[model samples]
Target: MKATFGIKERLKSKKEIELLFSEGKSIAKYPIRLIYREATTEKNFTIQTAVSVSKRNFKKAPDRNRIKRLLRESYRKNKYLVSKNTTHHFTFMFLYTGNKMPDSIIVESKIKEILQKFISKEIEKQ
Candidate 1:
């Protein structure tokens, strides 16, 4: 599978986003919180994700953007863990909940843990 995170892997539909927020189950790994649910639509990708950094925690736009960038990069690098051996399609929203900005290493490790937990949960549901 390609390791790159392309436009196809992003979660952008308004209806889907609303449904995800309204019905998705969430798991938290310190600074990161993942909200995910099995997709109702017949999408080709195994997972689609959105990243968020709250304005309350980060007052500056650049800070929020930086945090979001870090979140996306970490998720992209570790997404293969969730895609392997999975037949279901899922949508995820990753929220940055920490009061302070985190380095890439911290974000990546937390993202890895979150994805691993998500994969195990999905497996149990099968």
Candidate 2:
């Protein structure tokens, strides 16, 4: 099957996020903490990502929004690697635990590192 990402496959629902917190296994490697749960559906995976840029950090919504968008796009582009690697249904939550808003390249670099760790864990789980 051709693997592509969509809104439905991205974990955006509140219930889904809550479920992830309740049932997901966590993987942390600094800056990024991933929480994941097995998907019940046969043909889909979901991802929810959060970037921390609160009033205490950026003090502006636009800055936080931009960073969040960058994080999402980076994941959207690199997510194929994770999707193909998973043999069963799964959902992923990425929490940006950093104190500063990083440049896109930096975020992308951290994302790739985090994903590599995730892939390794999935391989070990097998």
Q: What is the lDDT of every predicted structure here? A: 0.92, 0.70
Q: Give the lowest summed-lDDT range of ten residues in model 1.
A: 76-85
* Error in Å for residue 45 of model 2: 4.5
Clash count of each predicted structure: 0, 3
Residues 1-126, candidate 1, lDDT per residue (tens digit)? Answer: 778889999999999999999999999999899999889988879899999999999999999999999999998888889888588889999999999989999999999999899888888988
Superposed by TM-score, candidate 2 places the C-alpha of residue 61 at a distance from the truth, in angstroms, of 1.1
Q: How far off is residue 16 in model 2, in Å?
A: 1.9
User: What residue pairs clash in candidate 2, if any at all?
Assistant: 11-47, 39-89, 39-90
Error of 2 at 67 (Å): 1.1
Tens-place lDDT digits, model 2, residues 34-103? 7787766554444444433345666678877887787787776787777668666777777766767677
